[model samples]
Target: MATIKVGVPSEGDTLDSPVADRFGRAPKFIVVEVDTDTGEIVSYQAVDNPGYTAGSGAGVKAAQKLGELGVKVYAGPTPGPNAYAALNYLGIKVVTVTGVSVREAVKAALKELGS
Candidate 1:
């Protein structure tokens, strides 16, 4: 099986660059990390939005990208159904958190998954 993976939202709030607003639409996505048995974040990357808005399947596209990267688990909040379905189809587990920092959420997810 592929190594387990995790993704979290970026620190920046806006997805668009000052100049890119004209060149292309803004992107929004979470930061991703890959790991081995240690459960430590090994590889990290940002999954940018594919289109102008999150409504344009950017989230799903991001999920697909994560799948391609062999991500097996994602930690986030209240992901939409489409995103959830995409992750499920990709064999990635989704762990949802409410009102918690990304770090805490990850720890909680790890605990819950017994990883």
Candidate 2:
């Protein structure tokens, strides 16, 4: 019954929305909870990106927020250096996704995680 939490930078609350291009500056983040036993998505929620308007250190802040939310995987475009470092330090896997919907990105990430 273990669940995996994946974070996707997106434009809306649903998986059908486009994934954002910038991780740190994305307008919102979609947190998807997946059932590891069945590889099925259980639930999802959209959270406002707190670092979207920060003048500096946005990546770091974004990483911290995701960590706080218990996000073990992040799927989106390349994150800034600071954000990448922060996510690495937190043991969160970052997956590259492009020109795809949030749902597609999450499925790819889950596949990469082998869960």
Candidate 3:
């Protein structure tokens, strides 16, 4: 099965961490490895968002960070326009979600990404 990595905006570095409502300003991102055929999470990592404290261009910064981590999909609340554009430029798929936790968001994202 193919594996896809999903980056979910999160409040903390855990699967149960609450899903952050703001993409660019999120404290961290829960990077999840999902199995495409089964649509299950195989592993995950949490990376602090450098853009959380940025005064400007946070969206672009956050997008670049995720891209650097090799995240193929972004699973979170709607991102700002600039972030969306940057993600698009990086060929990252964006999935809008209202899930409460990072784990939940990952599942939702996998579904949306056709995994």
Candidate 4:
């Protein structure tokens, strides 16, 4: 079984209110790690959204950075075409979900990916 990494956009207090600012002054990413075989969470962490603007290079760059960190699946609000393509090129899978907490979304991805 392969391990998969997942990332979620940060909602200051919850998933409804996503932080609008870039990861620069307002870093907002919650990354999670899961074991594909057992559907168990291996790790959970928060990363600074380095210089990424929503709907811009920031999302693509962030996805690439996450790929470097070994994340294989990214579940968040829908991403831009550039970011989606870039992530897909990196062999990362992008998913979309609504109204779910970051952690719950990660778990769902783990199960869906069969990681």
Candidate 5:
């Protein structure tokens, strides 16, 4: 079945984790695979952000990590300019979403991506 993976930068490591205030330095990324045809969540993972403690270029590192993780769309606060450029180059669609849990953010991302 067709599916889309949406990622949300989060403060914690769970579906209920709150959305992180910052994207590049978020501690974790909650990624969910949702079936495009049914909109049912197929699977999910909470990946530790490799760029969380980077001294510099954190946004670019985070973008690279997300791309490596196969995140088709991102749901969180806007990233920095460098990160934005990287994400755009990777063709990872981004949608602004905050004040919500990871699960909620995934839903929003799917909607924003029209999946």
Candidate 6:
């Protein structure tokens, strides 16, 4: 099976970092590779959020970046309309996760993926 890559908007590089409330405006994104069979986090890395500095169409730009990163799932607060549409067009799944930390959000996403 294909590895499930989940993206969480975050303020820092580690899972212990807090989750960002706004998707496009987030400072960074933590991309985690989760094992579908065991629901274990295999790896993770932080990517700079380009949209954080964009004057407009930030959501669209961010969504395109995530698509290029091969992110199959998004775990965070609701995104803006443009971003949402971009994600849908790219066939990326969005999951709502409420948590203080990125780790919590990732856990919630893994659970939702039934992994």
Q: Which stretches of candidate 1 lie over 4 Å from their true place?
A: 1-3, 13-37, 51-55
TM-score of every model versus the real structure: 0.64, 0.95, 0.94, 0.74, 0.95, 0.94
Clash-forming residue pairs, model 1: 8-31
Against the reference, the lDDT scores of all candidates come to 0.55, 0.91, 0.91, 0.65, 0.90, 0.89
lDDT of 6 at 47: 97
Deviating ranges (above 4 Å) for candidate 6: none
Writing each residue's lDDT as its tens digit, candidate 2 over 1-115 gives 8998999998877889999989998989999999988878999999988889889988888899899999999999999898999999999999998789999999898888784
Off by over 4 Å in 3: none
What's model 1's lDDT at 1? 27
lDDT of 5 by residue, 1-115 (tens): 9988888899998889999999899999888898989889999999989889999999999999999999889999999999999999999998999899998888887786674
Positional deviation of residue 55's Cα in model 1 after best superposition, in angstroms: 4.7
Residue pairs clashing in model 6 are none
Candidate 4: segments with Cα more than 4 A from true spot: 12-26, 53-56
On the 0 to 100 scale, the lDDT of residue 84 in model 2 is 99
Give the TM-score comparing model 1 with the true structure, all chains together.
0.64
lDDT of 6 by residue, 1-115 (tens): 5478898999899999999999898999999998877878889999999999999999988898899999999999999998999999999999988667888897887788774
Candidate 2: regions farther than 4 A off? none
lDDT of 3 by residue, 1-115 (tens): 7998999999899999999989999999999998888887899999999889999999899999999999999989999999999999999999999758899888877766664
Ranking 3 against 5 by TM-score, winner: 5
Which of candidates 5 and 6 is the stronger one according to lDDT? Answer: 5
